[model samples]
Target: MGGLEEWKVLGGEGDQAFPCLEKLSIQWCGKLKSIQVLFPALKELTLSGMGGLEEWIVAGGEGDQVFPCLEKLSIERCGKLKSILICGLSSLVEFGIEKCDELRYLSGEFHGFTSLQLLRIQDCEKLESIPSVQHCTTLVELNIRSCRELITIHGDFRELRSSLKKLVIGNCRLGALPSGLQCCTSLEELWIVSWGELIHINDLQELSSLRRLSINGCDKLISIDWLGLRQLRYLVKLTIMWCRSLSYFPEEDCMGSLTQLRELDIGGFSKELEAFPAGLVNSFQHPNLSGSLESLWIYGWDKLKSIPHQLQHLTALKGGGATIASDLESIGNEIAKKCGGLPLLAKVLGGTLHGKQAQEWHLILNSRLWDTEDGNKALRVLRLSFDYLSSPTLKKCFAYCSIFPKDFRIEREELIQLWMAE
Candidate 1:
């Protein structure tokens, strides 16, 4: 029900509305001010685009339960919502709030939710702090992003050390990472992005179970403790990009220990970076990393004159190669000439041409798509790659990814299911 600006209350005193309703969604009702109903069996509730809603009041005596079995609650774009007086939601497994620009505080009793597992808060411009979830022992995923005014996340990390697996915090104003973050020994995936005040990141050696780590767009980051990174023996993926001030690259000795690393992406250095780090080039030749690597992406090194010859030795790369056959060398050089040394375009073309037949390389070299301006070459290359995909389902899956927000991480099983649904 949308555009219901005259509604002030959903239920009166002593009223029991939808006693057996298991799911409810109220969207875009701008002036529907309050929800006073008792939904005893509600398992999911969504209030979205409620522009005039200021409060959600639980109507009952002090000890009476309103929604005893509610498992998921989502509130989005409720611009004026300020308070939610709710309790007895001990079974809530997921809670998400987004784009509530005027919300500064949550009046709900979140501490008693013992089964809570996922919590996400985003785009709440006025929210300064999150309520403490220290008592939620089962919480596994916490994601907070784009809350410009958010200052602190109130929680006791010691209590979440064992259960929390994934944590993403970005686009906020915190001067430093949350205290006690290193204590989450079970953390598997961590992303730190767009933070401006953080200068040094240390203490990551404590997260022994980490599998993927990404640090991007941190304009002020200067150095990372590579010695600590060497301790992550199980790390599979690592990405460091757009951190212009970061000058230190891990030594070859430090990279030797990452035996399980499958993907490495490091680029976007400052103009002051006169040359690519010698240590990184040598690290690529290390038997441990070279044999295990499957994907490699390196760009933004404008000063580098040539691609590393050591990259040719990474035999484990999936359908990727740097050297062409003797017959196709001239065609390969022609393709390179067309790319004009743009690092990003070169990387894309390399992926597309590698492991393809000789005729396919000629097709790409002779295509009219190359007649476009230099700036549009990347798009043409992407279009060519998309056309080459043999599986229609794979094409649909690739296109479906654009529906999500940038930097959003979706699990493999979930993404496959979404593709199937589509």
Candidate 2:
């Protein structure tokens, strides 16, 4: 805390004597720090929304390991935190850190986490590297995202080739896939997005056991080579999106090779891409592979906004229900026209006139406010929103008074003063 002012930290050393304390969460405790917490029996710990914490200084004990029973740790949105130490947390299995904007580094001896299975790091804008996890043989899943300043993944993961199954990397500066990944024959799922620095990934063909692959929004990537993806007979799903520079897909022969492929999603390629190769669609629809291709999503049409189709809305008024009066139907038609094919607008406006008296319905139909255009289109749809009111000023004040109880009396001066204050 630096003794700058008052601070609030949870759990004094006296709590260490409690053997049954299995879970502890310090949230929105702006001043909480390592020096103020000593929970020896805690099995899971979460720190969130801590605004003043600068670093997590590892705790020490007389001679034994601290946090000997701790297995799960999650830290999020501690905006001022810079670093943390997990060197002695040998029993930790799951670790997740996110949204600590000032964090620049993680300093710890990470090799001791023999039990660590899942690790996720996200939105730590200044985190520069992931400390070497080459020793985490039991690690199974890893996810890293939105760490734009994180240019390097320090782990080689040579020993984890057979253990790791899922990997995701997105919106980071990580330059290239590590050579160790070439030996990850057991890896099944992979997702990469918005990685601007990556230029080549031809080494991926080594993953003969791979099943799902997704690559998206990587502006720098230009091609997926045949040798890079052809041998994976087990591949079932593939998606490539927003890689504008890519002009080609694996050839028809290469696609025909994937007997198990079920879904294909490719989108956002630029106009330079050549027309579909001679037999690409034919091969996909071949009698031999008819049932294999279950879903195909191609979004190369850049000018297309959405699927063009008529939208229909079902409502009591739109159904020409028995509740309507003959005179107000014209006004309802006008409102529907103003809605301009949007179903939600028609419903809200239609519901406004439902169950109204004939006089009030006539007043709404004759209101002059709807004739004038508002400054904003989206806002215009709701303009003169309480169309039952007569004037612009009354439109603003009627909503406030609409909540009053039936026949409630109010002095004229107080009502005027309230409107002025508003």
Which model scores highest in lDDT?
1
List where candidate 2 sits over 4 angstroms from the true fold.
1-15, 61-64, 248-252, 277-289, 301-422
Please list the Cα RMSD from the true structure of every candidate, rounded to 1 decimal place: 7.9, 14.8
Native-to-model Cα distance after best TM-score fit, residue 132 in candidate 1, in Å: 2.5
Q: Per-residue CA lDDT of candidate 2, range 351-377, in tens?
A: 666656467656655656356554343
lDDT of 2: 0.69
What's the lDDT for all of these models?
Answer: 0.77, 0.69
Give TM per candidate.
Answer: 0.74, 0.67
lDDT of 1: 0.77
Which lDDT tens digits does candidate 1 get at residues 241-327? 778888877656556678999988777666577766777777778898879988777655444455668777677887554322334
